[model samples]
Target: MKSSTLSTLLVAKAIFEKTKSLVNSGDKYSCTAGIILLQDFVELVVLAVLDELDAGDQKSLESKSFDELLGELKKLKVPVVKSGTIKALNKQRVISKHYGQLSEPASIINYFSTAIVFTDALLEHVIGSKLQEIFLTDILKDSPSKDFLKEAIDVAGNGGYLQALALLRKAFFLSYEREYCIYSFRQQESSNGFFGLLGMLGGGRKAYPWTRNKAWIEANVKAPADYIQVDHEKLKTDCMEWGVSTVDVENFRRLTPKVVETEKGVWHLDYDTNFAANELSLENFNYCLDVVLDFLLKKQAFDDGHKWPKRVKSGPTPMIYIDKPIFERPSTTSAIVEYVKEDYYYTVDRVVSGFDVNEEFLYAHLYPKDKEFSLTLEDHIWGYLLAE
Candidate 1:
């Protein structure tokens, strides 16, 4: 268990105790405050479980309201708390906070009592012990890859084969990206001198052995700008060569085409029929899961470095301002624009000319330095700021 986890659990326990004390004080105001505190404690427990599970993005979760948080938890099927229970507690909280209604003393007591039970169950599920035993036992260890695998298996068990395959693909791509980054660093370091660096920059040199073949690069890379491309076929072959079972490799290969397809022209997941019954065997899916997990774990063991390099500030660059407001209502828009000058932020305004708008789709095109960039606004509240 990390120190942060420990501290969160401790705070949750303290809040629980305080809520109980307030309820016992026999005062209406104190009891209402206790109910609110209990709600806070439940939320804290939910967050702690999410962190423990290595679930989804913490920042996204932070932005969600209480109802939204519960909805997400339902999607994840977290066993800690039930949806009905959360809604009931939230209802009480709403009455106490917004309606200026004090819950009956017995109702408040019952709410607190239910909260205690819920928190206790949640702690046990997350840490495998009650609050008191948490410090006595070794801390829980979480693996994002393993968690993803579990989620995939759970989804598959519920007959959502396509969804499960999507999760498996996610796990595969995450590991692949990390492996590609490591290979990139190694290739960059091994190159000879300035020209060697130029070869890399100009995409003249092969980063990996598969890149030695031009046809393979075109088929696998798909895009000229994709430097860290991994060929799924090659990846399957490598896994088998590295001792992954043939059946597992074949099973994975069989599913790859269905997982992604070139529709019209653009490639994307074949979501429609991918989840149809009998498309994939349970045994093969399990085997493929094992194979991917084993391969990634083996690769991870070889390179124990962090997944990404720490970002460093680049040299200063010129700034360009927007001469006219991009949106009709500036307050309602959350869009931003920037230009890239060899890895530094530069600004662009109408003065740069070439501002084309497609009102039907809420998209705009900008031509800065003869390069075209497109921006769109959809459900995004904070539309976009392009720089990078």
Candidate 2:
């Protein structure tokens, strides 16, 4: 088809998708808006068909009313199977938009299904394809998540919705798993008690038992550096923490077949006969699909560096996992420098480079103004350094 015609069809498909979502909302205003958009979607589909037939015809058809456009399609020998339903949708839209009337919530689902049937019939007649041919997954950013969703779409088309849900669950699981590689410096303090005795026994100060223990902790325990990884098993908790609705997630989980993880952490669908016997309808599949898509879209924005509003903490700033390092300097009254007791200092610039979070996260969660401190360093650069 012509590029212009193709673009119009895509837009019409998008409008239909939006209509589906809005009608499902069951709100008075949203249902009314859905009616209006659905009518526009039908008109646009008719316009696209005319454009594909002839550009001049499309220009002429654009000036005609939606009813006239549908009638013109009949004159041109194009399919008009659902013209009655399309006209009814237009009437509802007119009452809602011009008369300020709201569609009955009970009728919204019927209207939604009618639009679906009409669009499918129209698209099939004109382009030898159904409305489902338009893949919303195409609009997602190119990533493994998109690839998985595409696979899910293909399997869903073949009526393997259980398998499709498994793929979608995996996609969501991988998308929101946050892992950060953190590096830290250990606090060097004077040896005391048992450790102090060991220090004196180990060549009295030459071996430096405190430093030796520190090295041991850094080497054997791997304390100086580690990874902070969120648990994938806590899917619902993680979703809530990421700002997704618990209700939506619970609904999706209820509709989709159970996804279980093996001891090896490999995930797969459990095809128990009981679950397999449960009737999974297209509407159920669509609900789960929409939930996953909504989550991924929001996650994509966050991955693109969009900041979410900071949430308030209930109490004092929590201590981070990083170890504190002791800073020793010369004392005015003592012959030897004294070790300054403090938490490990963390510069925002330095920590941001190592952590997956941003400066906003540090300022809000880890190092709020009340918890922040400043200290002079050998480099003479002034920057707020935080501690755990």
Candidate 3:
């Protein structure tokens, strides 16, 4: 491990311990601040790991945002924190700093735990005894193509879809060589000097030594797979069969302009304009990239005899609202309900038979109490307020 990597891990651990201490002290403000610092430290650790791996130059690192850095790490096959966990922590950090709000003790604790888990995993990947075991099994089997795939991922993340596609094409070929046990051969060129003199003396167009070895050797002589012919429709079907959406595949295809074969037999994008000037949507690129990467990772996990985590439930779960209040309502027609969660506030207007004016004792008598609820009704008034 590099010195920078070791120092980053130490700093992250120190901040994580400090955060735990703050949480133990029951100081919400200080705990929230500490968690924010911990998140920054975790990001630094990621950068340091990339530096240790020599994944990219400083100019490239400087151009990428934090999210892109995470993407690069994922491409390099580094086992770090999940993207969702990082996004949630970032959201909490933003709310704390910009809104001047401190998260509840429980949320703060969850954030700290997430940070610690990520830091541990990153350290294991960076400096553990079994460093080679950290990479996915597929990458290990076909190690030569790993660098090409990483480059493709980084290029795709940077919005160079054409160049990334080219890299992917090369990676596919390299991986195919491993899968099909193919070998290369060099063609002999015609000679005009001594070889020509030998040919004239032998009264033949060319002369060759029978003892010379062939250009290529294959232990298992067999026909290789036809890699040149790519069936886009079949690829799309395969992606769908692997649980990827046709919509996302189609979106990716749209961004990939058709390549044309010139008279000289060279393939190139049809457009003549500059690649940087071409309008590309980062959101679309990210969505497609996630879909592709997810499919590949899941396949790799399966090949390695590992169980992939269950797919996260999509959409949103319906919020359950209890019909009864903790205290009896004073009004029989309408009421004003106020809910507070941490520093954020929400109001619910309901037409009911009664309401409670108690500001300190109101609570929703939910059948099942959920501590994770973002908002809880704190007070209710007998009638609707004019300001509302």
Per lDDT, the best of the predicted structures is 2
The local distance difference test score of model 2 is 0.58
lDDT of 2 by residue, 119-213 (tens): 67777777765554443433468777677777887898899877887777666644542221111112223445444444333222322233434
Best by TM-score: 2
Score each candidate by Cα lDDT. Answer: 0.54, 0.58, 0.49
Give candidate 1 misplaced runs (Cα > 4 Å).
80-82, 135-388
Would you list the clashing residue pairs of candidate 3? 329-355, 330-355, 331-354, 331-355, 332-353
Q: Model 2: residues >4 Å from true position, as ranges?
A: 1-18, 25-30, 48-59, 72-81, 121-133, 177-250, 258-265, 270-279, 301-388
Q: Candidate 1: lDDT of 26?
A: 84
RMSD of 2: 15.1
- Which pairs of residues have clashing backbones in candidate 1? 1-139, 320-347, 334-383
Predicted structure 3: lDDT: 0.49
RMSD of 1: 22.4
Q: Which ten residues in a row have the lowest lDDT in candidate 2?
A: 178-187
Lowest lDDT 10-mer window, candidate 1? 377-386
* lDDT (10s digit) by residue, model 3, range 1-388: 6666555555654454455457645678877787677677667767777888998886798688777888898899988666688768877788888888887877777776676567557756765522112232223345544565566667876777667655544443343212221111111123244433332332222112221112322322222221122345655655555555556555444454333222233444432355335534444443334334444443454467756866586533223233322233434233435322233222333333323443322223221133334233233222222211
Stronger candidate by lDDT (2 vs 3): 2
What is the lDDT, from 0 to 100, of the residue 126 in candidate 1?
A: 68
